[model samples]
Structure formats: C-alpha cells, structure tokens
Target: MMLSVIIKRTFVPGGFPIKYIDEIFKAIDLLNVDSKYVPREGQENLMLDIGEAMQGEAVLMAEAGVGIGKSFAYLIPGLIRSKRLKKPLIVSSSSIQLTEQLVGDIEAVSQILSTNFTYVVGKGRTNYLCYARYKSGNKHKDLTDILTLQEEWKTGFIKPMEKKKWCVDNCLFNQCEYRNSCDFYNMRQNLKPRYTSSVDCIIVNHNLLVEDLKKKVKLHQPGLIQEGHSIVLDEAHKFEDIVRDAFNIKINIKMVKRMERAIKDLEFDLGLNLKTMRLLTEFLEDFNRELIKIYAIEGKYILGNRLDIKELMSMKFKDMNLLLAKFNTMKSELRYLDFKDSKEKVYDELDEMIGTIIDYFESIGPEVSVYWAIYEKIFDVNGLALCSAPKEINKIIYELLFENQKSIILTSATLGGNVPINSAINQNRAYYEYQTQALGLPESTIYSTPQKSPYNYEENTLVYLPSMDIDVREDSMSNDIANEIIQLANIMDGRTLILFTSKKQMESVYGGMLLRKDTFTWKLLKQEDNGSVNRLREEFSSQKAVLLSTGAFWEGINIKGPELSCLIVVKLPYPVPDPVIKYKASTNPLVHEAEMMIKLKQGTGRLIRSEMDLGIIAILDHRIKAKKYILQSLPFRNVTEEISVVKGFVENKMAQYLSEQR
Candidate 1:
C-alpha cells in the first residue's frame, strides 16, 4: 500500500509519509474472499489520491461511486496522517448513521493494524444527557424516549455520552459531585487530556462541525488550523447546504413555548419562586404575540433582505439586558439550593435556554451574515433567524477552514451543486465548478479528480421516462402521481419507493393511496407518517412494501435484491420556494437549480445499492425532459416511453434474483 501510494502521489508536492498509511491498512484482510469482499477497481485509486491529498498543504475533491470502499479510501490515509503528523484528523459525514459507522470501522481497522488510536464521535453536546442536570431536574416523560443522534436537548438517560474519556468539561473532575457516576464528564476528564487533545481522529456529523465552525467564527479563533491537523469530508457535496442551515440562527415559536412550559412546570413542581418564572413567561408571551401578529399578516414571508444588527441590538436593549440579568440571577440562586435538590437542575436548564436565546439575538450583528424574520403556519413555527443565504461560504472556507491546514479531502457520490455562493457569472459558469471555487482555497493548494462507479448500470438498470397524458400541472397532480405509483407497484408486485419533494405533497399522495387501499397488495410507508426512516427502512427491507417518502429517504438507504425493485421520482426535487431558496435564486438562478439537480441525483441514486441489485427508476415528471442537467451523471441502460415496459423489466429482475437464491 505504501509503495503504491508513494508511486501515485506525484500530484501533490510534499514528502509523503508512505509508511504510516501502510501501517494503518496492512492488516485489513481483503483476501478473505467472501460475498462482500470483492475489491472495487476505484478503491485503490481513491486511497492513493487520498494519500497524496493528506500529505500536505493541498485540497482534493474526488467523487467515488457507491460500494467503492470510500470510507477506508480516505479513512486509512486520514488515520495514518493524523498519527504521523500528531494532529487531529476530522472525518465528517452528512448523517449520524455514517458517522457511527466510521467510528466503528476505524476501530476495526486499527485492531487489524495491531495498533490503537484514540478517536471521539464529535456531536452536539446537547445530544448527551447532562447526568447532574438530569438527576437534579424533573423527570419529564420525554426523558424515557430513546434519543436518536439528531436530537438537540441534553437530557435523559438515553445515549448518555457513552465515552467517558471524551466528556471533559471545565470542572475539576475530582471535585464535581457527579464525576464518578457521570459518564460524559468523567470520560472527557480522563480521555480529553489523555486522548482527545492528542487523539489521532475525530468522527463528527456535518451539523456538529458546522456548529463548531460557527462558534469559532464568532469567537474569532484561528479555526481548524493547528500545525498537524487536517480534514476529510466524506459526503462533501452536502457541506454547503449544511453550512447554510448551521449558520442560520432561528428562534421558532415552538422553542419559545417550550421554554415557557419548562419554567411554568418547574415553578409548580419544584416550588421555585413564581415571581421569576412569571416575569420570564410574560416577556416570552410578548415575544410570541409579536411573532404571531407578523405571521398572521405574511404567512411564511421573509421580513426583509437584511436585518440591521445594530438596529436590533438597540431596539431590544433594555428588555434584552433585563432578561439576561434575570436568568443570571436565577442561576446564582441555585447556589443557595441544596446540592441534592432537583430544583437546581431545572433552573440550570432554564438559564441555559435563556442564554441560547440571547446568543441568537446577538448573532445578527456580524456584517458577513443576513438577518431576517419568517412566519409560517406549518408546525406552527415562526421566528427570526440570522440567515447567510446566497453568499460567501467559499471565503469562510478558505479563510477559516484551509488556513494552517495540512490536507483537505472532499468526496461524495453526488456532488451536483453548480452556482457559487458568492461568485459572479463572469467568474464561473457551472454550479459544481462554482462549488469547487467557493471553498476559496488558492489554486496551488488544491488537487482534484473524479471516479466512475464500477457497476454495470447498462446491464443492471432501467430508467423509464414515460410521457404522461394526465394534466399534472394542476392541484390534482398529487392524486395523479399516487395512481401511477399504485399501478406501478401492482405491476412490479409491491417493492417500490416513491420520492416526493414536499411533505405536504407526499402526505396528499399517501392519503390518495389510502383512499383505495384495497386496490394494491403492498403496504405503504411514509417518512415521519409511519415512524422515522430507520423504522421505515426495516419494515421495507423485511417485507414487500411500497414506501412513499420525501427528503430523508432519497439517500443513506440500502435495500438489496427483491426487497426493492423500483424507484419513483414524483418530481424533479425543486426545493419548496422557502425564504432561503427565494433569496438564493434571486442572486443566482443556477444556485437554486443546482440544488434541485443535486436532489434529483440523490433521489435517482437510491436505486441499485448493490452491484448485483437490479432496479428501474420511473420519473413521473414531464418537466425532467427539459432539465437535461439532471441526467448528466446518470447513464440509463434503457429509456422508454411506456410504464408496462419498465414494470416488465422490474418483474424480470425480481424473478432473476429469486432464481439465484434457489
């Protein structure tokens, strides 16, 4: 491995530490030669490029198709680099499932190497239950629920910061009452100094990385730029949109009401002073009333192009200070409470919630960001957010992410965005090109490549683009899509996934299907409508079911063989014209179009997870015929104008799989 990497690392200018990568992957026994051990042609190549990418001051953008051993292609290089350089290497992914898989795979690979490396799964602190806080506060029923990594609140016993070494806080571990029993704090105390500070790698989801970057920006710390540290983004394509979401500071009504409810409940149950809770509640109510009034007028409309942070700061000066002061006073009052008192935890959380709200209020003053308010009736959510829409993420990336870095590698199966966040049309013409530039790194610091999947798509897949006679431009489109899906599922014998652009539309289609439930032999499962994607995935993989989903179902799902045979694209994934999309499209239409293209690609990519799996993609939208860019990455083996032909293709694939099993 070392010899191969050294020979191929001519792309980047640096003395390659070829030995480290060899040490990391040498024990990975691919020679086991089992059903899953088929070595991909692009895997070794990706590893070589990653090795060069990790050698020194360089940025590499590589796209490897599914089943390309992408995780280790970068992981082995990153681990070796982190170990050799004695700097932290961050491997960030878009989803928690991927992050957890990397964490586990890193350990397995290290064991194979006959070596040990310290690594922590970096997530938002709120995902872990603060043991001290949990024991001290009211035992809310919500605490009993199992928490997925996506949750933001730091409460309950669910997933209690399992690694004690990574749980270090500012407190002296020995003096803290909960130290011995505190899973998170204790872990951090021992491991942070013993490991994390010197640890080789940190596995984190994109959200946490973005949040940390946002904090770093606000604090003005020299960001991710230690001498030896480097970075790798597994699903790098999602970074821009993830960053956009992270940078936005939203104050939703649901959160405000939750705060009020927390205060009121604790005040009654813990015997806390009613005076303080009342005061807080009154202020919150006033805030909610103002938001509701605005929402009543402009349902989901953006307030303005930009908010003057100076004006917001001055506008709420006295009220803001009073609220902060009150929370501070409440926090101080906890000192007088008994150490064992549960009321202490309640007030502590209350104070933190208040502080978080204040932080949002303060986020707007920055010149690089845009602030706006939006009112929407959906989920009854409405609030003010510090939005950095349609702007200079590339500048931030170059200045903050790349400075003082050794290597940066970005990879994703679908890297579809084209318009630059802040680039002019004269500078770059395509979204992907703009995306490559928007990272703002100097040309000298970057090296790039693309990889095609080893899959025989021409032999294994069919793409159906049938002309629809039904009028789909009207409100009845949802019903039309539902009927087509019903017909397709019956023809294919009930293994289909229908991807929708809007949840409302998905629900409407699902409802339409329900109206004639007896017409089909398969079960229909909708994302969120029937539990989460995890649950839906299990149900679908285990049985013959037609899964109707949007958003989350497009990617990060695998249903091999006969369990999944068809994918239906309800639309071309045009993002709902939300404030963020509206603002972005206004500046550059390509920005919005690129996002839709990326989503369309992701939706299409859901089919054929395995090289042996066969599936058909039925694109229902006629508009896709005009949007040729959506088909740029896809190579369809068969493109037909008939639904029955696609259905026959699917049925044949399923029968073939069954015969192979026999």
Candidate 2:
C-alpha cells in the first residue's frame, strides 16, 4: 500500500548523533535563571532523554510532573534536532495558552542555545484574513469598521477573517481583483505556507495539525509536514480528541438555513417549486435526534434507514444540488443587473449555503464512513448538522504520522502512566495505549518515560474529601456541592478554581451561591457570563475570583500563585457516554474509569504548580471512594476524609500567603 503522501520521507543518515549532552546541560544552566527560574534535575534528565530519543528516531511517550518543565524539555530537543538536521520540527499543542507559552519559551531558549530558529505559526483557513469577503462588504458592521480602521496600515491587516462566516475553501487568492492589495494575498505569500522556507520548525494547535494531516492523507495535499521533518505533540494527552476532530466532517445548521434561504430566491426567479429543499431541511432536523442515539452508545456505521438518499431522489423532485446550482447561476446574472444591491443578502446567503450544502453531500454520502448529526435549539447554538469520521483513527495516525517519520515526541504533564494502577484502572490505560498504538512503529523505535513532579506535594497540598460522605446521585447533591464551595471560598479568601463536568451543574450551583449572598466577599465569575475563556482566565488571575468552567478549562489555564490556594472538584470527572466513549466503555469499563482518572489528575495538576505554593483539593463527590480504583488516578500523596479540619489548613495557608505580602 504505497502512498503518494511523501514528498520527503528520506532522513539524512548520520547527520547528527545524540552527543549534545554538554550543550543540553549548558542550555539548561543558562535557562535556569535566579530571577523566578529554578532548575530541576527532573527537567534536565527529561530534556536529555528527549534529545537522545530524537537522535535514535524513537517515539518518546513521556509523562512529566506539573513543574517538570515539560515544554522546555521537549522543545529543546525539537529545536536542537531541527537545527542539527537542518530540517524543521513540527510542534503541536492542544490549547492556545500552551501554544502561546511555547512561543515565549522558544524565545527564551533561543537565547540559551544562541540559535536563531525560524518557526511558522500555522493558522489554518479560519484564522487568515480573506480579502475577497472584506471587499464584498455584505452588510456587516465589523467589516466596515475594519476597512475604515485598516486604512492606516500598509495593508488592511487588522481586517482579518470573518469570525462568523469564514469560507477558506472559496478564497480566490491571486485571482481576485484586489489580489495585490489583499491582506490574505500578502499574508499567504509572506506569513504562511512556509514548507519551502529554510526554517524547519512549525507550531500549530492540534486542530490545525489534524486538518493538515487530513489534507495530506485524503486530499494528497503536501501541507506543513514535509520530507525528513519530525513532530513533537506537547500536551499529547489530548490526542484522542485530536483523532476524533481530524476525521470529524460536520454539516452545520447554518449551512442548511442558508440553503433554505437560497431555495426561496430560486423559487421566486426560476419557480422550480423547491419541494426537495424542504424535504432536505426536514431530513436535517430529524437527523439531530438520530445522532443523539448514536452518540449515547457507539457510533452509527450506517444510519437513518438504508434507502435514505434513494427514497429522496424518487420523490418527483430535482436533486438538491441541481436546485442550488440553478440559484447560483441566476445570482451571477442578477449581479449584471441593478437588482444585485436589492438581492445582495440572497446572493451572499446563496454563496455561503452552496458551499455548506456541497460540503454536506461530500461528507454525509454514507458510502465510506461512520457518521452522526447533532441538533441543538438554544440561544447561542441553533441548528442541525451531521458529523462523519473514518472507522480507524489510530491506524491512520500510525501509518501517516509515525511510520515514515524519524522521530516523534509525545509529552504532557498528565499522560497517565503505562503502569497498571489496578485491574479496572489498567483497562482504561490499555484502551488509551490501544488508541495510540496505531502509530505501529517497532518497540525499539520509541521511548517511554514518566517523570514525577519535583514539587513537595505532601507539604504543599491536601486532598480533602467530605466528612459527610454525600452521594453524588442524590437530588440535593447540587446544594451540598454549592454549600461546600461557598464555605471554602470564604476560608481560602484569595482565589479558587472550581472544576465541573457540565455547564448545567455549574449554572445551578452558580445561581445557588449567588442566592446565599454571603457565599463570599469576593466575586464569582461563571464561564457562561464571561465573553471568552482568555478573559475569564485573566480576570481570575487578577482578582479574588472563583472561576467556574468545564472540560476545555481543565488543563491549560495555569494559575500558579498563592492567591490560587484552593481547587474544588464539583464531581468526579467521568466520560459522559458520548458515542466514542460509550462504545469503548461497552467493551471495557476500566478504560472508561481510567479516562476519568486522567481528567481528575489534570484538574488536580492545577494545584501546587510550584513547591512554594500551598493549596487544598476538596472533592465534593464521594464517588471517588466508591470506585476504589479511582484512587489510583489521584496524584495527591495525602488523602484525608476529614473535611472539618480542611478549613483550618486552608485558613493558615491563606494567612501565610497574605502575611508574606505584608
């Protein structure tokens, strides 16, 4: 099975051996500054292991403690490898914060190594500014504000992509009339598509990297990763989600609505009696219910009746595409006349909807993939859409990403160890390894290590469980969790991070705490109330704020100060039986349980970010005890059931934190 995938899979033999020990030690020493920088032996060893692993062309599956400097550890190796080989190293992170952190770290490490590494920040189709759309100016107030504001710059660089309706596939590039003056045109040439550049390092979020991976695999497009380049996935714990997202082809509700509006115009002009469009719309609406069923269990390999498209085409109506095609042709003609201004809304709607409908047809044909469609009628999200993915994600990653690559580094603070915790916990770890096993390189081709955090957890942190042993399933459980949080907030008195599994639960407790009026003298910021996660993180870091957020906020927002002295766990972070988890869990409950523990560890990893910072982890839910294997997931050295004394412990820490300030 030869793939046209490789433009450059050939590695330079004996280009550079892993003999950079002195250089590594010296770089670590230089980075280990007295000004808020403490060098740890764990970090140094990890960096050495990573450098050797890259030199050996091995997959280094490593887990480091919270303060092990994992970013610098892997990054130093990657930068050195790229510099040594004269080839770029691709680094992918899961979160924006981590990406930003890596960029900053690269700057600092560049000083240590005294090597100028040219790295490209890969922002896929969404992030780039589109010059065609800006000129179209389809009644958007922001577009107007951008045009007026952008006149001051050499190019209207500030007027980037449309945040709501970004269509990267349809970009005209050099073909547009304003191509010379276009922001996107200049950016595409100057900023991005740097595979041909001498600089071999590129940094991207998991989503962008996965998208590029898909482009190479499915479309055979030579994207960011080229010949002889290696990839290091930092925050590698989020690989499963990346795997899911890479193959996820979603047909959104907005696309359907646009198609509907376009159909109305097509009927007005051509009068084709778009009964097929209405039927397609109904199919989308019903598709939502069908998706929920599949998501709750295992994914649907084939869904919504075997004869779905067959029955639809036989309904004495034209095909859906034919109707949309006619509308687009009529739109072009309307532009020639004066009616384009009057029908600009319809014209733009037709363009957006046409692209979306085509995307749906291409993805949801149900001939080659497994898929599900989701629908939500809410204030923020309203519409129905279908999502599709290939059946084997691990296999694809292994063959495409690892098999031909020289070296791959997978590092994260919370990548659960391969060591079996218990029978049940081991099952989840096995499942995790199984999903990642698709990389399929020889055992000798990869390296694996688990580096413990150097922080003094026993002295700096307490894992406090409720003394009352309240059941998580009870109807009054919300009140119990909220009550504990309110008291803990007042006692901690500086800042707190409360992790929740769901927004509904967070809302219920958030509203309940506000009703108490004396929950604390400090302010409570809900994730929903904050316009952005970055804003929420910034506010929480600045004030005595209790930040409430869910899954996405689990790992990245690192608040490492005495002010962040307490972490409250509202519930055991379990895998909600979403289709992927449900199917995997059906075969092995241990895998599901292990997944929960990994998430729990990620939340707890937030506390005691440094040895000097002391804090307490209060688990409101008693489920952690019920599942004895769950204890294996917890990173805390001292677990206490006595919730009464936790108040005193946190109070004394808070006093000390405040006194140090005085």
Candidate 3:
C-alpha cells in the first residue's frame, strides 16, 4: 500500500500495536483501575482523522479534553505505519519527565504487538564523556569534579554518571583511548549502537528537537537514511517557548567568568603549557581590559541602556574580526602539538577553552544582539558580554518545520484560548514585554495559530465545580473556606483530591477542616513532600484519604475509583508577577491582560483525567465573580453546577453538592 493512500476500512476497536491496551482492559475488567478507555462519544472519529494525518503529509491540531488518551491515539497509528512502511518513527516529548513515561509506554506497546523495533534516545553532543579530554586532563584545572566522580564509580560509592553530567565539548566518543574499559564512556557507547538494526521509533523532547533544528539543522533532515521517517510532537503546546529559547541567544557575565576562570586554572593551577596558552592569555587580558574600561565608563547604567555591546563592538569591527581569526588560528594550531602518549591530550582541553571564547565573540554581529551585565564581587571581573541569536523564534519555526513541508502533529492540554491559533502566536510577548524591548523584537509582527485540543472532552469527561462562596483569599474577616471543605468531606467522605493554588491556602484550609478521627480518617499530603507523583497517587488510593497540594497536583495526575470521587480546586491558579512576565507585559497589552486566563486553565486541568474519573472543582477566587471575564473562558461553563452563597451556611451548600455525586 502506498504511504499516501488512506484506507477506507475501519479498524477493530481493540488497539493493534500497544500491549498496555490489554493491561488497561484487564484493570478495567477486574475493577483494578478506576478509569475506563472511554473516548468522548463521537470524538473517536479523531483517532481516524489522526490516522489519516500520519498516513499523509499534513499538520493536525487536535484539542481534546484531559481524559482522552491523545498519546495512544497518535502512537498506535505511528507504530502500525512503521511496520507497514518499514520506516523509523521518531517521537519528541516536551520534558525529560514526560519523555521517560512515553519511552516506557512505547516499550510496553511494542512488546504487545509482537513487533521487532530498536529504540534509541538521541541527546545533544555534550552528553557523553570526551575521550579527547581524558587523554590530557593535565591541561585543564577543574578535574576535581570529574576525577572524584570517576573514583566514586570505581569504588561503587556512586553509580555511573548519567548523560546529564556530560556535554559535547567534554565528551570523548568511541575514539576515546579508554573506550575498551572506561566505565562512564563504555556504558554510554553500549547504550545505543549505530542504527544498523530495525530501530523503528526514536523519541526526544520538543526542546531537544527544536534545539537540534536550530543548532544542528543538517542532522534532522528527513529521509537522510532512507528509513520511512515521520515526526510526532507530543505536548505540542510548548513548542512556542522552546522555539523562542532555541532561536534567542543569552550571553551573560556568568559564562565569561567561567571561561576566564578555566583559562586561569589551566595556566596557574594545572601548571601545564598549551600551544594557545599565550594567545588566549593575551586575548583574555585585552578583553578583560576593554570590559573594565567599558564598565568604568558605564558602571552605574543598566546593561543595554548605557552601553550597547553590539554597537560598541562594531565600532572596532575590523580589529575584532582579526582577533577572531587569530583565535581560530590558535585553535587549529593546538590540535597538532605532539606531547607523546598524552602530549596530544591538551589539544581537546585547549581547543575547548579557546573555542568557548571564540564562540561568544563570533556569535556577536549584525544578526546578533549583545548585552552587558554587572555582577558584584562574585568575580573581580567587570561587566560581561551577553550575546543572543538575533532571529525571531517564529522565523526559525517557519524555516525549519513549516518551510520544510514536514508533517507536524501539535497536541497540548493547553494550546489556545477561545481565540484561534492566530491569537496564540507571539502572545508570549505579553509575558515577555520587557525582554522584547530589551532585545527589540516587534510585538505586532509575530503570528499565532489556534486549533482545538485533540482530546475528547464531552464523552471522556465533564468539568465539575461545587458551588461555594467561601473564598480562600479571605483571611481574618471572612469565614474560613475549610469550614465548607470539612462539610464536603463528611458527605463524599475521604476519597477527595483537594487541589490548592498555593501552599498558604492549603495549609489554612487543612488546619481548619474537621476530621472524623476514626470512621473517616483524613490524611493531608502536599506537593513538597519529596514524593513522586505516582507515589503520591498510590498513597491517596491506599489510604482513601484527601490529598491536598498546590499547582503540580492539578495536572499530570490520574486517579479513579472510590479513592478519588471529588476534585476540589480551592482557587484559580493565576500567573504571579515575575521579571519575565513583567518584562513582556510592559510591551504587549493583550497578553498582559490575559495572563490570568492562561494560568487558570492550566491549573483547572488537573482534575478529570479520564471519562470514568469524576470530581468537583471549587474555585475560591472572587475575581471570577467580579470580572465575568474569567467565567466566559472557564471549561464547561454550562454543565458546571453553580450555587450562589449569600448568608453563611457553607456547610449546607457543601452537603447538597456532595449528596448529588454518585
């Protein structure tokens, strides 16, 4: 069958590739799992629609509710296509934590389908040990951390250091002389061999993928290896921020000091001779002197306002270019110095140290904007150079994804508001107003696209809000909201998820709530308990008690059965004031205004993870009442049962809502 041809036949209801489907059903059949695999009514058609998207070259913007299995909806088809077309499927997630979960799920599904596929995680170059650096550690100063970690691994004081500890500049690939028996390098090398085998699916985070697209554009080109290739972007809502960060450049004083310190360490501490040592020292001294001079002239002023680093640097354009040329020359020269068995070892260290500075200087030009920062005594060094990639993030997305005609599946629990995809574009400016002005990107020029969520909200789940007047925001003068919660606890009993917008509110309510002591025991759990989400969910289910937490508790939590019959959203989570938000809000009026809506939706989404999961959402914010703006954007405004509170019978109203629940 041609990859472009869509099949007319509707597949069976049972999933084809995923093994967890059986386990999912088994849990439901045995009543071990609280939620069932119920896609919202007719939205099952979305699965078919997505199947068509995977079969051809098209972009899908699916906006479904929290309960619908959006990940499975896409993965099952991707796996089947991989088998039929003999192509490699690569899936990228938004975060490391989410990446881990999807990897596990893919493994389970692959086993169940009886398919032979190899999975390899693609990370940046920095994640492996630099065999080149190990050959000549005598050239660099900070071998303390690396040497101690290696010693720990040898004595089993510490396990093998994960990829998180390594960087591309420091990584020594298979060429490392110690590849035969080195623990750290050997383990990583063995993790993913070259894709000579049928490695059908590759998984990555959106940030990593987008970063690769911007930083390593040639590496991500489709059909490079002739394996049937496709990209699945999970949690697609976060693509904008990832794109933004990937395109933008941040050069702060902190980086300069680290390089300066490394150079100083190589010279004074390591007591080693480097071919580029004199050149680097001379350059550093020159750069340091120039920075001190600039700082002295513009000490009291802010970074960009007083001295535009780009503008000042450009004034000496020819000299700077010559300096960079010489730095590169010195870099190439270091590679040829022969010091014997380990004489060439300093080449990697010297190359890395010099390259760090060269990268910073070369990155600054007409296409780059530079900023200067003044740090206190942390370093005797004056203001440091900060340079950023001049291109807008949307431009990078257009160049890499849209311009390439690659099919993209963008899915997120929170992508767009009532406004279409067009509105979401550059809406981040409202949150990043100041930075935009500081970096100088036009606020009006960016484009925002809107599409519905891919999850099925109606059949999969309904948004529930228990009507109440007790606002958690009220302190001494108003009645404590806990009084109302204590009453609701009595009716629904202990199986409730009490979600709070802040820890301050949760503690207050928990303190005021009435406990049954024996018949209905209540246990309070906060998000800061140093427990994993799964562990907390397990605790909530086993104890059949109320689990109270702030923001993280709202979304990314799945619970069903008698253990969690109620979800209490004590308050609407709104974005608090911060430097980033403040900066953006100063530049964009629309985004600045709608910050509350974005945060509220993200917070409310915590409950009703699936169709079988039922719960109550009680918003304690008075802003929703006075503004009327917040009310219109709330999910399921019509179906959510509302109760007006007038007198002070918080308990009676709570009793009525709890009694109505199944």
Candidate 4:
C-alpha cells in the first residue's frame, strides 16, 4: 500500500546501517487490510512522518487544522511507539472533556482498525471516591456534601463529571473492593497492563503536567519519571500560561462556605445530640478562625513584618496540625451514648471526617505556599495558597524527552500564536530565550516547528475585516453588526453561523434582526443557561442554527456542513475586566497581558476547521484598522485570510468560489 512505502522509507532511510525498509513493509503487510477503515492519503502520510520524527527522540509540533483527524494523526504514532518501543504513551490534552473523548475515541477506533492496544486514564488523586470516607461518614464531611451534590446532579442542575476526578486523599486505591469494577480502573486495565505498569503514556492536562513537573523539581527527583514512557501533548500551545497559573496559587471564600455547609449537613445527617452538635459548631468556628489566620500569613501578595504570607501560612498550617491532634484527642476523651450500629456508624464516620480535613491540610501544606491577601467580594481577609512554577516548560520537555529518552510529539490546531490555556496550544517558554536561542535549534528542534495543515492557507482562506468606525453616539453599532450578519446569512442562507463576543450582544443582535420574522427562515440558536458546547454543536449541525454564545462558545466549538458556511465576529474579543482576570491583573500585569493574548487567539480559531471545510469569517471590529497589533502575527495568518473571504462573500464573488468548488 502507499502508506507502507511511506512508513518504510521513514524508518529505514537511505545510508542507514540498520535500514529495514523492505522487511518492515512485508511485516506490516501481514496485518489484515480493512479498506473502509484505512485513513485518507493526507492523514496516513502525516502520521508516518510524525512517527518517524519521534523515533529520533525529536519533538514535533504538528499543526493539524481543525477536523483534519488530528487525534488519529498522533494516535497511530503513539500506539505504534507504545507497542514497538515497549513504553507507555502519555497523551495530555487541554480539557477534561477531551481527555474522556480521547480515551473513548481510542477504544472505538482501535476495534475498527484492528489495533489491539490497551489504555488507561488517570486524573489527580482527588478524583476517586474515598473508601475510608464512604464507610466512615464521621471523618470527611465532604462525602455527605457530595451525596447531596449527587442528588442535584441527577436533576441536571450541576454536572459532576469534571468533579469526579478529585475525591480526597484518604482513598486507598489498591484496597478498594470496587477497584476491579471502577470505571477508571477498568479503563486502565483495558490498556493491557503488562508487568511494567507504572503509568506508560499518562493522559494529562497542561495544568496537571505542569504541576507534576513542579513537584518533580521540588522533590529533586528525576527518578519520578523513570517509568518507561514518553509524552504527547495534544494541545501544546497552552503549555506556557497553564504552567504559570499552575504555579501561582489562589483560594476563594466560596470553597470555605462549601466546606462549612457540608460540615453542618453532616452533623444533621449523623443525628448528633445537642451536646455533640455544640462541640462540632465550636470546632467549625475554630476552623474558620484558624483558616483566616493562615490566609493572612499566606494569601498576601507581599510579605510584611518579616513573615511573608508563605511563612505565615506555614505557621498557620502547623497550628492546624496541632489543632487536629487536639480535636482527635477530645473526640476520644468525650463519651457519648452508643446506640444502634447506625449511630456508631456516624461516630466512626467522624473519625474518617477528621482524616479528610487533615488530608487537605497536608496536601496543601507541602505543595502550596500560603500567602496573605484581600479577596474582594468573597473574603475581607483572605489567605491564599501559591506555587511558583519553573521559568520554562523546557524543564518539562527535558524530563519527558531527554531524561526519559521517550518520544514526544506536541500538536494543536492553533499552536503558532498566543492561545488560551483552555482552548489553543500556548508556548510556556520565555520570550527572551525564544528570541535568542530558538533560531539555533534544528528544524526538528524546539525552535523550528512544523506546520501540518491539509490546505494551502493563502489560497484556501481569506480574512474579512469590516469597518469598526461605529458612531459611539448611536446605540446602533450592535444593530449594524446584526444587520451585517443578516446580510451574510442571506448570502449563504441556511449555512451561516454567527458568534458573538457576549451573550448580551448576541441577544441584542438577534432581537434587532427583523428579516427572520418572515419568509427569511433559518434556525436561530443562542447559548441560553449554560448549555454544553458539544450539545450546541450537535444541534447546530442537525438544524443549521445561527448559534450565539458567550465565552466558551468562541473556542472548543466545532461546527461543519452546509449549516455553518459563514462565521461573523462581532468585535475584537478583548476580555472584559471580569472578576478573575481583574483579580489576577491587580497583582500581576505581565501575566494578565499574556492571558489576554491567549484568549484573543482562541476566539478567532472558531472558524475553518479543515482544508475542505470552507467558510467566510468576518471580523466586525474597526480595531483592525486602528490598532496595528491586531494585524500582527498574534491571531495566526488564517485570521487575516478569512477576513478577505468574508469581504468576498458579501461582494457577490461567493458565487465564483462556489463555481470553482463545483
């Protein structure tokens, strides 16, 4: 097959002493060929090249444009390397949803492709259900809280899918009776665990990868990664900023309230007597007081009185250590009525409860440093936790690649520009190093990355920039933007998708448009009340809806087919001074600016997922003309080209492009 020829040449290049091109081809041909499951030529070629590149211990950045089957492009190489090299493949993505999707997709595709590869998925230690907490109900109040939460989850009010990854520290993974039946553990076993099961290619997020890297360095142990494995970062661009956030620390009052409420609920559920209830209430008050004191010492941005927030937090945590000892001692000394096993169950549960609280304190104590700061709105005197990450992601790449000598590949749809941690791939390396030393690296090195798109970008895409000079006096800029969308929508009819920077703006535009009231019929969908992006995309594809959304809508959304032929950008999606951004900006300007850049790129990447998937993208912001930075390489060249396509669509030349397609 054409694929075998390419794969053979890749592994056994000319002039190599160990060339095995002929033998390799024959061996691979022994595998049954399922014509229907064979990848397209473009995908096969790219996968073969990526596999060859990794075999040399070279890190490759494959920029597979949206929907070019990127997951498979990398998966084939990862699976092949895992089996051939006898190492585990760790695939990390930017989101939990993608992590779950990767696991499922890999399993589903493997069956069809006849690749008998085993796989496993793991999250942070907190994700599992704590057996000790489950049985003891006395110690960890959070278990009761989660049960209450599960009730709400069943009603579809809150999704616990993401939260299921972090349970508590008291969980004993090896001893759990459910280990064999657990969904996560079962998935791990399915990966075909061999005698050397120490976590081969672990699927992790940028946040977790960065966290582990920090831990590895702090612990001064490179041996932590000695397990036979390589790393594959799926959405690599996010590596930079995620490392930054993962290193810094912050705590919110909402979490404290959640803890307090859970404690009270546990008290009631356990049916404690008035005396015991009083003692528990007093204990919570003490816990609250101690938490505040700790926050004062740790959460502050600056240190004062010779004790920085970190030191103060450390002292406070030590005090908490003492308090837990005293609390346990008192519980043993005071005798209460021993009733039926149910009452005894509640009493024993409290012991487990103390263990849970102690676990949180211990986990935070070593991994996070305490800081003292004022948290607006939530707490007047909030103590925070913080951790400073390594200066560069190269430290991580170094451990994953050089120290481990395992194959690593980084791929993303938008890796070239400043991309958000949640959506696009970000560069974690410092700018000065990138500017000075990056140029010297090999084309296969960290500096010189590869572009893996399926189409000629300049020819296939044109960026359209509409005039942003709106009269500030007229409350009609939104109206005008809506009108423009309507005009473009008519041009493409049912095949247009309009993305708003804000839901309020989306509402305003949709409300202002009058054409859709008559024979100008088209499906109009807006992201109302926090709907899942996957569900929205499903609806958009099935019913060609003009989907309107706020923040999450712009990135991580995929829509194709005749339903979404055009995308309208209402404005340059500069983030508002939202609480979280504002909070971070108040303390660190550079980090905030980096975050804004990342967000902007993510917003623009919503259109033109693949080479064959064509669409007109219009940016209704005059900022392109006024601000020179908007024209810079920040948003990728596709943004510039897509603007031209939007202009062409409105100018009646869309017909010409259609004829070309025909």
lDDT of each: 0.63, 0.64, 0.50, 0.51
Instruction: Give one digit per residue, the lDDT tens place, for model 2 in 294-400.
Output: 34443331222221232323342344456456445544554454433556666666655555455545544444544544433321124444566654565677766
Model 1 spans > 4 angstroms off: 1-11, 17-36, 111-118, 130-183, 190-193, 211-225, 252-368, 372-391, 417-431, 437-442, 445-447, 469-473, 658-662
Error of 1 at 637 (Å): 3.5
**Which residue segments of model 3 deviate by more than 4 Å?**
1-43, 95-118, 121-170, 175-197, 218-228, 244-261, 264-391, 420-521, 529-551, 568-571, 576-599, 626-662
> In candidate 4, residue 660 scores what lDDT?
38
Model 2 ranges with Cα > 4 A deviation: 1-15, 29-36, 128-144, 147-170, 175-187, 190-196, 257-275, 286-370, 379-382, 417-445, 586-590, 659-662
- Please name the candidate that would achieve the greatest lDDT relative to the true structure: 2
- Estimate the TM-score of every prediction: 0.75, 0.78, 0.59, 0.60
Please provide, for model 3 over 1-662, each residue's C-alpha lDDT reduced to its tens digit, 9 standing for 90 to 100.
42222234333332234333333333223322224234332233344555555554455555545555556656666666666666666687765556666777676556555555566665434333443454455355455766665554333233222322332354455556655645445434433325523666777666556655664454554322232356676766556656755654444444445544544543422333342344444444555566666566434323222233444566756765776786677667555644445424444565665666577567666543323333332223333434344334445566666555444565555544542223343554333332233222332222112223433344333343445555556655123566555555555566667777555556556655534334345675654433455556677778647777765565555554456665666666654443334434454544443555555666666555544444445565554566565655555443343433211222443344334434
Q: Per TM-score, what order, best first?
A: 2, 1, 4, 3
User: Highest TM-score among the candidates is held by which one?
Assistant: 2
Give the count of colliding residue pairs in each prediction.
10, 7, 41, 57
* Candidate 1 lDDT for residue 511: 92
lDDT for each residue of candidate 1 in 247-363, tens digit (9 for 90 to 100): 565555455566666567565334444465555556545654555554454333333323223443456657767766665665566445444365555556666666666556445
- Cα deviation of 438, candidate 1, in Å: 5.0
Which pairs of residues collide in model 1? 164-187, 164-188, 165-187, 165-188, 167-188, 168-188, 394-438, 418-431, 418-432, 419-431
